[model samples]
Target: MTESYLLGIDVGGTSIKMAIFSNDGDLMEKWSIATNKEKDGEYILEDISVSVKEKWQEMDLQANQFIGAGVGVPGFVDIEHGTIDFAVNIGWRDYPISSILSQHLGLPVVVDNDANLAAAGEYWRGAGVDAEDLILLTLGTGVGGGIIVKGDILHGVAGMAGEIGHVTMIPEAGSPCNCGKSGCLETVASATGMVRMARETIEHNTNSRLYQIWQENGEITTKDIFACAENNDTEAVTIINNAMYYLGLATANIANVLNPEKIVIGGGVSGAGEDLLRPLRFYYDTYALPKVKEHSTFAVAELGNDAGVAGAAWAAKTKAK
Candidate 1:
């Protein structure tokens, strides 16, 4: 009997990460291709198709050996319709990515939101493994969120349920957010938000290490903030504490309702490791109800860049069954 293979594709604004997995969830091969954005990304899926065919031929694998392909799309995914309602980065609007990829690759395709895929990946093989309920918070240039309830990704009616970044943290007199909101969690906790906080701190206290670095380099990064805080810089520590406070509040609120088994933190900021977790847990403990807090745990995502691709493979395997 021939072994079955699964194809996983994660489409980002800049590149497409692709991987082949075995039936039992072992990763076989992985690679990436530049995302062609010519004509408003019209050819992105076509490029993926060509690459997959080349890869399969290189490996001497027949198309019939594959179960199907799953794609983690970066935007509002309408799972039921197999379309991306809108993806500003990819320049797709209500585009039928699933059917189109299925036609191009001659295999059934499943498409889901990229953030949700990352969470699903963690749930299946990373930090949230063995947990029936969990939430993922990714802190990058911007923040992204995903929720898993009862071992399945939650896609609200509008496919916008787990937008934790856009959750209102400071509703009034708060900083502006890219989502056209005021004082969103993204504006307070994302890398960009950390920089924004640094700028604000420097303006008031130009004598601090954060201000000195900002003035010297004309910029400050989240790493700079963390470093300064490590040296006991009061302003830097305050900014980090404030950001984690909001995160904890939101986590507490979510836990109160969903009572997830774990809340997994991922992305670049998570590189702070102990520094981030310690403070975040401190705040979470301060806010979360005793009952829910006792049940919900915290973890850092084990999978790094592989989360999306892994989740895509899971989607394919799940749908194939």
Candidate 2:
């Protein structure tokens, strides 16, 4: 009997990651290639096919050994029709991703939102492994979210279910978000938000250590802010706490609405470790309803970048069955 394999593809704005996994969820091989989304979508698909073929040949395996492929795209997808509705970050719109890839590679393919797949990855094998209901918040350059109920991904009408970042957290204050909304959660809780906060703090509090660091580096990023906070920079701590307040408020709203058993945080900003989680925990405790708060445990994501690939492979396997 031959073992079955699944190919998982995670498409980001700058890179395309591919991973091969055995049916039982063991990672067999993984690699990545540059993604020039400004080019045609078909070109990107062709590059992926070539990479997959190369990997198959290198491993001395035939295409028949693979069950299917799962792709997680950073965009809105019409899952039923397998079309990418739109992805502003990557400049894609209503692209026939599934049909194009399936025809090009001669294999069945499943397409879904990247954040949803990351949440599914966590639910299946990462932080949410113990919880049937889970919500995952990914805080990178932009914020993305995924919601799972009863071990299934929630693709609400238009397949835009887990877009928690765009949810209005503050209606009248703060910087405007790319979503055309003022004070959306992403405006306050994302890495971009953190940088904006740092800029404001530096202008007002020149005596702080963060100002000195910025004076030395000439520019302050979210990572630099986190480093300053670790060194007890008052301004850095203040900015992070401010960001956490919005994150907590957003998490509380999610809990009050979905009441999931677990909430998992991931992406670049989460690297702040205790600095971010401690304050977020405090805010969540202060804001969340008692019933839902008691049931949901907040934690950091364990899978890191591999979550999407692993989740995509798992999704492919599940769909194959």
Candidate 3:
């Protein structure tokens, strides 16, 4: 009667987060490893494999005690084949990550988009728990999202279902996005977007506190923007309100159609907490249909950084069953 364990791995640009979970969904241990991006990230998987093996041995665990490993990959991945189409940050292109990791660990592996895993994590153990339909928005350097319908992630046919950031928010006179598009949602609703907006504001309105802070610190951060807004700085408040307006409109549009039970907001910008959600909800309520608005709720994500690992574990466990 040996206990079984599930391994969850979240691969990021600079680091990899791994966690071991019990079959019943309890987290046993978690750790981080530096992602070796040398040689086009050729050694990233190898590093993960070696570290996992060492940790397993240190814990005196038998190989047979493990169920499988799940990975939250940071790019377009073909889940059925476990192939990564491209991950610009980590320099992976058309790499067969799933089979490679499976071979190295001698365990079955499941691979999915990192955002999808984040949503799954929230749905299983975080803010979206108990909801059959939900969406998780990660507002980091770039905005990423995941949509869950009926307790399952909605990975579209091209594995590009929940790319909320790339959705065109402004098609005319918008800033250029890294995705080679102009006026994408990522340009306005992400941490980077916040900073960019703040900078633009300071350039135009030299009297704003954000501009004063920028003059003192040489740069402004997302925190400064929210903090200034909290103090009722007109420009900061305007920037935040504008960003939330677009984000809310985008979310409400999705809710109008999908009518998810909940919309969970996560990532670095979400650290602003109520400051972000309050204004976001203001705009959401303005756009969402009356019926959908009443039924759908918005909340901050509770899982934080653990969402990816938790979701990866859920993927492994689900596939094992």
| Model number with the top lDDT | 3
* CA lDDT, candidate 2, residue 254: 84
- TM-score for candidate 1, residues paired by index: 0.97
Can you write out model 1's per-residue Cα lDDT over 1-321, one digit (the tens) per residue?
474898989999999999998977789999999988788789898899999999999998866788888899888888886888888888898799988988888888899999999998999889999898999999999889999999999988888989999989998999988988889999999999988988988888878898899878988999999998899989989999989998888888878888899999999999998898889999899988998999989999998899999899888888743
| Cα lDDT tens digits for candidate 3, 65-160 | 888888998999998898999998899999999889998988889999999999999998899998889999999899999999999889989999
lDDT of 2 at 90: 68
lDDT of 3: 0.92
Candidate 3: which stretches are off by over 4 Å? none
Error of 3 at 315 (Å): 0.5
Answer with 1 or 3, whichever has the higher lDDT: 3
lDDT of each: 0.89, 0.87, 0.92
Candidate 2's TM-score reads 0.95
Q: Indicate the TM-score of model 3.
A: 0.97
